[model samples]
Target: MKKKIHGFIEKIIENDIKKNNQMILRTRFPPEPNGYLHIGHVKSIYLNFTLAEYYNGLCNLRYDDTNPKKEKKKFVNAIKKDILWMGFNIKNITFTSEYFDILYTYAVELIKKKLAYVDQLTKKEIHDYRGTLKQKGINSPYRNQNVQKNLDLFSKMKNGFFSEGTVCLRAKINMSSSSIIMRDPVLYRVIESKHYHTQNKWFIYPTYDFAHCISDAIEGITHSLCTLEFQENKKLYEWILTNISVSNYPRQYEYARLKLEFTILSKRKLQILIEKKIISGWDDPRIPTISGLRNKGYTPESLRDFVQKTGFSKQDSLIPLHLLESSIRKDLNMKSIRRMAVIDPLLIIIENIDLLHCENITVPNHPNVPTMGSRKIIFSREIYINRDDFKEYADDNYTRLTYNNEVRLRYAYTIKVTRIEKNKKNEIIKLFCIYDKNTFKTQPKNKKISGVIHWISKKNVIPTKFYFYSPLFTIKNPDLEKNFLNYISKKSKIKKNGFIEKDLPNNISCIPYQFERIGYFIIKKEKNKLTTCHQTVSLK
Candidate 1:
């Protein structure tokens, strides 16, 4: 069903290309350098780049750094880093500020033709004049000013003749049009603040709506694709090009933006979270930022697969994060080496003293993959298992070990509980068990067990802190709340004294591995050198 719909959209794209053969199809991923790129930006980047790839065209990375108040060079660098991490390379990296001189000349041309004028009305007054859909807007006092006077005033405004917000250059668009965006939209405004890229060369700057269209045309872009929010501005986009007499105007197309369950895509809200220290930073592993995902154990191949499987859509949709997670799990399950780690450890002591010595037991890197070889893990009189694996009493459905119940200690002999020990808090601290030596590999027994759990010898255990990370939000749609902070998950705990098997490699980097029944984790390196191993695990 989805393929048929995508094929239909593909045909429209093909027809567009056929009609405009003179202008080679070129698209762009333009983002404001005010904040870090999130998962939503990933979708946009993917869509534009994928479309360009399909048409055998080029994709440009254009930074819409028109707003100097909130943008910075740091954000520009971070955005570039993110795109590279996502395995995408743009044909060129450009900025809207690069064509400031050209845009200024175009603005002058508009003013000389009596199509624009410098207005002295305050922002509030301008808004009041630009009435709602049912009402016609009031004309500005200088709307009918002479072309020569308007040009002189615009030049003076550029030379810092007017204070910030005291003057603005607006295009003389329709005043009675139902679309509010066409009611003499402000093209350029005076901002005294220093820009991150262009610096203090000019005090006046062009707005996004004005700068974006011109930049696209200047770059010879064929498809000016954007989110659905810009659908209403399509007419104005064409109007700007028509009035300026641009020979080859780029075609504008809108698609639904990506919205994911349990993720918020608002840059303003994300900024607030960073400022308030609610998150570590933009690249915090808990965050959905591209860098964050990379740090959290996501591979480029996995991300590309995830995006391809999700495909494209016209209607707004909230993708189940499960789809992405499933892809990662499938990719990692084949690649990640198997290891034993007990987060909440429960002691299991052997009843027989004859099996007190440590024995080297070999285990496969992956269950079905033998070429990957095996690692030797020690088996001794006592072992550490998961606390959830045992109970004083059990029903038939309980697969793990229980009182007097026998279960295989994964890749080893089966063991039965002999006795249980409890502490002052009435919590079971340890269990006494005995292994069936007759079931050793040399003399295989015909006995069968319903469940098998992983374990490491207590004497050869590596005690360390395991930081378990879950999703930052408790709900599916985080942005739906009036205050996203209210939906943060407070139950996400960090265990400072988690345990792992002795067989785990020393000083492991951010390597992904399955923790048996406890899901996947990657080792997080810490600043302080703790002699004992410490790892942060992001559970899948």
Candidate 2:
């Protein structure tokens, strides 16, 4: 049995290598450096890198930086950081701009073969000629231009003779084809904007369709993996490669991108949010960006597990945010220390108690993971509890501090609510309770309690500002809408005043915690030492 198992594994490995010999199944993650990567991009990066690892292949971090107008160095750097944070190391790094001369030569070759031509039609006119969903489409007048004229015009385009968008080089594909991508797509266009890498060496730039395939060929990439949205363009991608004399013909494969509820994955919409100041930036914690998830205390292990469980599917699916959060909490629970914090503080006075001696309450860092050990908490006469935990009216089912309710002080003793103190306005200002110290569990007595609550020392409570973030948009699907900006929610906010226990010293840094009974939180170090965490509960 053991010999057979090893044989099967070896056979699979041998087949993978035999099928892709020279390049060894090389894959490239070609992201346009226009914005920071989001959760969907995370899925793509993980899938590409992991597949490379699976067949003992190589993965390259290739930037599809064709549109220099929207691309930036900051976005490229942030993308690199996000991929690294997700535990992927791409040794071969490249950019589409690096192969500009080679791609221009390829275009010249296509023109020499009369497969492409220089189009004089304006951008709007070209779009109109391409036809709409209800139209059969019309061909441009320049489609049948002379091959020598097309070559000369293309060279002039590279020489900066024409202004941006005045002329464009397009493939002479069938205009009446049902597939919209086949309708003589623009191969190259005049972009007078200064590029970050290539600079002013050329005035014309290749479109994504023209540049991407050439880039893959240049890197000797064997597998060009992308999202399913490009399925229609697969033919065009192959056409570009078949026309060019490349040593290896890379195959383009597409998979459905990850879609999550209560989030927007559209880069354009996300960019609008940043430009309009609807979000702090692309890395805003509210955003589904890789940086945002990292800042939210999500472990790389959790992200990997999420991608693994979701797997690769041909059809698009909407993943619930809770599924991702559950994965994060499952990992964090084993590592995060249990801490007590009162978000909405209410004074609790344990009357008839002496404050001279401070009691030490020992609590384990993790209950099931015993190796984490324990910490000491100082207990005193007065402490702060959540304001929502107490109420003036209640039914028999109410176990917490109602008018005269009885509850246990967690690891301490049981306490009975004796009276309620209020101001002249008849507000429930304070709760007066008497502790039955004899009923302590370690030193037991004949007493019982209905419920227990988390409390922090009033004097030890640190007042810090907390930033609470929610979904950036009001709609469930921000990408589906024609106007993404109109769905922006005004309720997404940042609060600067919140409190936590003083004993949590290490938490003063940008640390995170699973606040007992209140969901996860992090100690944010903005202007104030605030505890910022996402609220798991919803308004619904």
Candidate 3:
């Protein structure tokens, strides 16, 4: 079934279809490939691609790789891989560099029409002249240069005659206009750095504001979708397209961008984390990058569901991180195989059973999913359980293991703790327990066992490392701080030794598993004699 489209953007598109009758909707996701894509970009990707699919239209993935100073071929490739990982099979992949010749022609057309001029103003001078929101901008002295002279200068700028930042092509728009973006925005600038795609082919490149609208028009895009931050720039987008000779003029619409709690999506900030070695890379599970979440075992379905629930809106708001966690939890609950793992393993010896005895117990892979089948787990005289599951003393409300208390072992017998062994420091080392042989599927006569704990036999267990991830930032909105790095969580990631059922596949693959009482986790890396699993979310 086609997903119902009912956002404000959808209303606009529906009205446009009604007005144009036969308009074939076309949208594009234009990303500047300087860093890995984060969850914020996923929202845009979901919106554009899903809208196109729903309207029986098309969406294109375009790289707005105009800034050669930071953009790289590696980033371009990473962006493509991330999109594909999100299950978007975009065939119309393109780059702004591909349309450089035509963009240059469009700039020349604007210059010849006295709509653009070559400015020799320094960077600071241009910034000073642009004016703030409270004050109107002053016109540049070069604003009135003749079309012939401007054209000669622009050609020279493009031909590498001008040094970087010395010359730029600015549109001849109103300087005193209420919109600062329309106050003669720079259309092109000279950059000496070699572009990843077109190395040294041209000395000048178009700014995003200039190249974006023209690129949309050139590609015959009917609806240009953007975040609300671009609302002020919409006027410039329209003005440039209106002045250009393009056959098609795309309309720009703005919606709220994703502002996720506890994480900053700024590429510059993320890069800083990388440069400081604060994270392994962009894919560090603690961050919100798409690859990071994937590495943490988040499914594409959950991310798409998150975007859908976030919805489209005109007003900006910060989305709670739990909303995303809830989506993934709901998804993993249905799909993940159930297994028993002990993060902080505590030894428990069943005294009644023979030390050499081992029994095979059958457990469903997924309790609700019968078709998922079942696996046999070893039940031996000695087993391991999470230290958190056992308490030396507990209140009546505590249902987990306690000294002299009986608790049901998941898919096994009910066990009663007889005693505990402690180290010299008073830390509990292990527990000695006795199991009721007949309580695997029933309560012991005249007694109720409300607590059920997961356990793995000490025999044939896979030694594993577990990573517990918390929010990268300590505050709800780290972006509010002048230096977001100050709010970095000291314990964002905690690693510990653990054990998983021996029945687990040798190659666990990327699929996550519900670690019974612990949490959902997926195999992250495997080395000789040890496997590493990353926690996706806690059982709660």
Candidate 4:
């Protein structure tokens, strides 16, 4: 069962349904196919698809591929893959190029109705004439071109007579409107470049402002949702739909976009990171993209829970990145199996035990999840523990292994540090310890052992490389900085050598495992003898 969704948009939808019982609620997630989907896009996807499911309506996945210069078929396929990975089913996949004929017809209809005209001004001149918010726009000299001449020029534009930036189609709205978007916004422009889908069928393409609402109307979409940045463009959205001959006009709604701290959600900036080799690729674990999160061992359930926790609001706010980490931690805590790994190993030799002897011990996969079963691990006389777990001298609050103190070796027997072995440089090389054979699961009768540490048998250990990650940026709002690159964290990724239990399954799964006392980690096997372990999140 799913939780009831209650928001301002849901209330508006309910009122609309009440006004007209026959009305069918339809929504669509329209993304420009220029880059991969990030966490910001996931919020919109969750809203549109979940709302459709809750209201018993239909939601479509539409690609706003009007700009052929930056768009690609690979991006379209990647977006589809991301939506599927988020556990949402795409019922109808569409592209703005699919309705090129109908859109051109609609543009021609506007021209014949004297509502739109062809503009011969250069791009810069049009921008200067549009004016700023404090200044009113000036009417274009060719605004009153006769319908016949405008149609002839537009037809010539379609036939590739004009250069790419020479001419464009603009709506004939008021020049002095308070809203700048209403000041005769350009409807269509010549791209010259061949589209990935259309493939040189025509040289002209409709702008997003002109094609989006019409495309929504053609698909019978009832609610067209967008981020708050497009609140001003909503005027042009309604204007184009109202002037055209389309019957079904979709209403537009604006919500606050996701702004995460210590992250950059802009596709342009992400592209810069990729180009400059600041990171690996879009799937780099430090990035907020969907694929990156997946590669970092984040589950779909965790992302969905995060979206639900954030909800939908009209006011924009910067969300703390820790909230997202908390969701993933809660999810992995319940499902991940517990294992032992030693990063930065320190050798411990059991002087009292036989050097060649080994014993088998059964350990539960998860302490809380008894039904997950158990696995047997080899416990030999020689073992390796984390270097940080032991200290030559101890403080009163310290509860781990130290000189002359006894500590339990996790699920194995209790051991006491008898002496330390050091090198000529005064660095501790190893610790000689004696095990309490009578205290496997019981405490020593004469002494209190309050410390516990995880260890792996030297004879049954698998060498692995572990990757630790920190925040990509140093400051909270790096996106607000002029030079975000300056704030890039130098210690974002740190690699270390480690040893994992040898009884790991032959067929490695994508699911993360809780490395006892450390954090959750996902294993990646390499073609060589070594394996790589990626830390998903710290044990908080």
Error of 4 at 464 (Å): 0.7
* Candidate 2 lDDT over residue span 98-143, tens digit each: 8988898899999998999999999999999999766778989888
Candidate 4, residue 446: lDDT = 89
Give the clashing pairs for model 2.
465-496
RMSD of 3: 1.5
In angstroms, give how far residue 306 of model 3 lies from its true place: 1.0
Tens-digit lDDT string for candidate 4 (112-142): 9999999999999999999999999999999
lDDT string for model 3 (249-356, tens) is: 888889999999999999999999999999999899999999999989999999999998999988899999999999999999998999888878999999999988
Off by over 4 Å in 3: none
Candidates 1 and 3 compared: the better one by TM-score is 3
Q: Higher-lDDT candidate among 1 and 2?
A: 1
- Candidate scoring better on lDDT of 2 and 4: 4
Could you tell me every candidate's TM-score relative to the true structure?
A: 0.92, 0.92, 0.97, 0.97
* Candidate 2 wrong stretches, greater than 4 Å: 1-23, 355-357, 442-446, 494-498, 505-511, 527-540
In model 2, the Cα lDDT at residue 274 comes to: 81
Error of 3 at 18 (Å): 1.9
Compared with the true structure, model 3 gives a TM-score of 0.97
